[model samples]
Target: MNIKFVCFSLIVMLFHGSIIAQELITPEKAVSLALDNNYGIKLAKTDVEIAKNNADILNSGYLPTLTGNAGANYNLDDTEVGFADGTNRVLNGAESSRYNASVDLNYTIFDGLGRSYNYKQFKETKQLTELEARETIENTIVQLFTIYYKVAELVENKDAVSQTLNISKERLLRSQYQFEYGQSNKLASLNAEVDINNDSISLMNTTQELNNAKRDLNFVLGNTIPEDFNISTEVDFNNLYDKNELLNKVKDNNISVLQINKSIDINTLGVKSESSAYLPTVGLTGSYGWNKSNNNAASFAAYSVNTGLSAGLSFSWDLFDGGSTITNVRNAKINLESQNILKEQLLVSVVRDFNNAWDDYQNKLSVYRLQEHNIKTAQNNFDRTQEQFKLGQVNSIEFRQAQLNLLSAELSRNQAKYLAKLAEFQLLQLSGEILNVEY
Candidate 1:
């Protein structure tokens, strides 16, 4: 069956414009709301944006660095000067002032292609962040779908329990009438009343359980709506995809696999980044400067000013650093190998998980189908017994048994249906298609 149809069948709802009325929400609406309001998804998006910013070309090491600096200094202290001709002078309040300013430019001419590797690594990191966001969205969607279906199942079960409770109430009334008119014994009326009380308690418990399920659904939707709501009753069990096909897609599309692959690329680049330490680093440095100094003495004062321009090509080769660079390169290679192994392991796990989910889905489908047939038979039996009870051909115990059987069959069927849906959802998530779910 089409995936959209399957999702639609789970939460088919109609909306109206009335504040006092129950709000009609479908699984699609809930998912959309959660996507908009979920804190985890918002944070994941922020991380993607940050990675994108870090990957910018300007942030790469290829860009030049320019800076301007200026400084002034003043000093006052006793000073003495002596010349080679044996003339000596001394001043009590000797003062000196100096000023300097410069504009410098520095750029890396080459670094063994380390900048290129850095750029590639950052770009890959950005892609990884985007994939992480996709993972977050997929998780949220699966969570919403699971809770929504559980609420639907509980609602159905509550209805069945309510029906049984009504039947018990009616039986109690009939038994009371028969005893009041002396047509039946007091024990019959007492047993009927006891049955009614038991059914009422069961209904109350079911109602509470339904309410709790609704509350959980509300929480999954980021608590944007009221909990007192009804959900779609339809359960669709249609499997159309092949296990081998899904397994093939998992390696390329699964978020964990993609992340591991990216990590391997980063680690490979890390080896390159570390190998850069072996080669000489070339840089261009240039500066324009102005300087002035003045000295004050009692007899004479002197001052001088100078301006200069300088430029140079600098290179550094770390011939040896006690074997640290070699160790780092070896470490990086080892990390890359480890990451590759991890990717292979994850692929195996993904395939295994997909198989398990597929098998579970098939098994649940079988159970759901069986329970569906049981519902039909149980319905027929209950109808027959109900009629026989009216005709004095069946006892109260027999009629009650038929009612309970029909209810049990319905509850079991709903549970199996949701369980199958859960398994199907897992398969989609494992294949990285859960994020593609349409609203």
Candidate 2:
């Protein structure tokens, strides 16, 4: 019955009559839109930028600090004085004024190389943020493609159901015509009508599922308003990956593993930074100042001014802090140990996930190949049954069963195709290759 042509025609009619105005979205376009618009990726990139800003040496306390101070005062008072020689003096409207200004600079000379450790820590933190951002991008792309393929799968399934519906409709018409001519019984026509009803229900269910999948795809694309769109129904099954190579790449390049490694490095630096606290801190301090005072009513001096520059080297030692430094250093070491343990655990998990995805991919690919063969056989069987029914050599039930077998095979093939594609994407995501793929 040339079901492929029937399915394609029905899909064309369905779209033209129902959703002809919808935009067609390609996988590349979906990925590009998600990269530009997805909120999670945007936030992750923002975090990377913040980390980059914090990576400055200034933030690591590697630079000198300069501060300036200035002040002025005015006073008015009445004064009375008694001298040691028994002489008394009284003054009215005594006025005084003072002004001062200073600029100071302080630079840490040494602190057990803590500044260097801090700088390294900041750089590592920046790198960690960048990895996190990459992880976000990878995750978004994976989700986008997953939903994209789901839409494609549902679209194909809907077409298959629509083809069955068309077949059932034709069968019903033939049965009615035969009964009118006294060739088929009333029961035969009634059964055809019931089958048509069932096919219609299946078509409706497939359509509903397709619609829901499209909505989910739109959400993942970060659409502000849901828009009706058609996705390319082509499924690519050409990916070839070696398990050993994938495992090696995941060990070195997986985003989560890399992030944990960075964390461990940062923690190591933390340990060094805390340990530095036990050493004496040496600093260079310098200041320049100007001071002036004036008295309107004074016996010894009417005005005075002072200006000076001072410089010195300062040192301080944390001789004791009630075991606080010891506690902090111990805690930092413990945290470093914890990060090491986490890295070990993460490596194990990464390997486990990759293996699982790899197995799923292989299984799905095998199933898809089997379904491909099964569909061909089903199509041949349906064609034979269809020809025999035209000659009245096969009953209506036999023909319908063949029709259902063909429909089931088509659906299974469609499902297997997409499931295999999804599994492939999962492998890419686990290996962190999803980010490196050309959209």
Candidate 3:
């Protein structure tokens, strides 16, 4: 009997090893695959890049602008008309056509610090966009772990159902032998058969559930169902961790928190930038080029050539705007206040979430250990009762109850294990550990 238990334990170990071997994916691989292929996350990243490009456009203001121009005018004729002299004065130029061309440049010398403030706003906006992307990525990350654990849990439950069916079949075989030999009652044998039938039905239900879970996981992973992909069945679920560490980490890592705070900075900069529009701005303009004239007309032979250069300063001011600037400044302040309130609310919610996740993890871990121990004890009791029944020392009802105990123990074990896994992942999420973990 002891040898049988050892053999059974060895079989379990071998099965576990095979399952582990069939597992081809790691948490890191799954996350990397999902990030690269997931539609929502990929699109979010693209939006961040677009925002970054927008920020790059602001740099153009720092560079001087260069341009060129050309034009010409024409008149009817250029009869040599000159000062009153006794001599026939001739001038090769008349109102035939005039041409002008120039290369010009303009550069901002100052703008009441508008450029500086606007540049700052763009930078802040860029930072916010990046944070938004990260927040989206974090959401996807939590989803990946959550779905992975759910699928794993269902698979575990299916395995438990299989084991339960096997035990029920074995009990039925034992009861049939006893009844045929006139050593057991018919009702007991009937009950044994009924238990086997019920277990079979449960196995079918469990298999269906496992299939549904697999399909759901495959959908999220952007992959075809593998039909036999192995799932890791165990994770350390009872390790005590410091809540203080998590609190400290959230400040440095929470994208939502960082983004809302930076939004106030953006609003403040916006008000400053808008205010600068009312102040006087200084700039420089310069041009230098040559001019030529051409005419296509009879008696209009024209010759003209000119060259010049000039440079000067320019200024601009809005003067007044019927309190528009004042309204803008007030709105910016209001927005800043709203952002501060948002940050405060987020912090409170995150703290509560962490505490809840931590407690759930602890409770699930405890239940899992209890279920593990229960399975061992129940298995032993079932085996002993079957032996006594074979010896004609126990009744069929006691043996059937033993079988039920074992079945319940196995199911509870699977449920507890899965619950613990979910709790651990949730804890990781609430504490920002999921985001910090390298994929």
Best by lDDT: 2
Clashes of 3: 0
Clashes of each: 0, 0, 0
Q: How many angstroms is residue 28 displaced in model 2 relative to the true structure, after the best TM-score fit?
A: 2.1
Q: Give the worst 10-residue stretch by lDDT in candidate 1.
A: 11-20
Off by over 4 Å in 3: 1-23, 57-60, 68-104, 179-194, 224-227, 287-293, 296-310, 392-398, 437-439
lDDT scores for all predictions? 0.84, 0.88, 0.77
Reference-based TM-score, model 3: 0.79
lDDT of 1: 0.84
lDDT of 1 by residue, 1-439 (tens): 6999877765554233243367778766777788887777888889999999999998998999999999999988787878679998887778889999999999999998889889999999999898889888888888887888888888888888888888888888888888898977887778888888888888888888878878887876778887566666666555488777888778778889988988888898899998988888899999999999886774254887889999999999889999999999999999999998888888889888888888887888788889889899999999999999988798888888898899899899889888888888888899887767543
List TM-scores for all candidates, in order. 0.90, 0.90, 0.79
Look at candidate 2 and tell me the lDDT of residue 409: 99
Candidate 2 clashes between residue pairs 3 or more apart in a chain or in different chains: none
Number of the candidate with higher lDDT, 1 or 3: 1
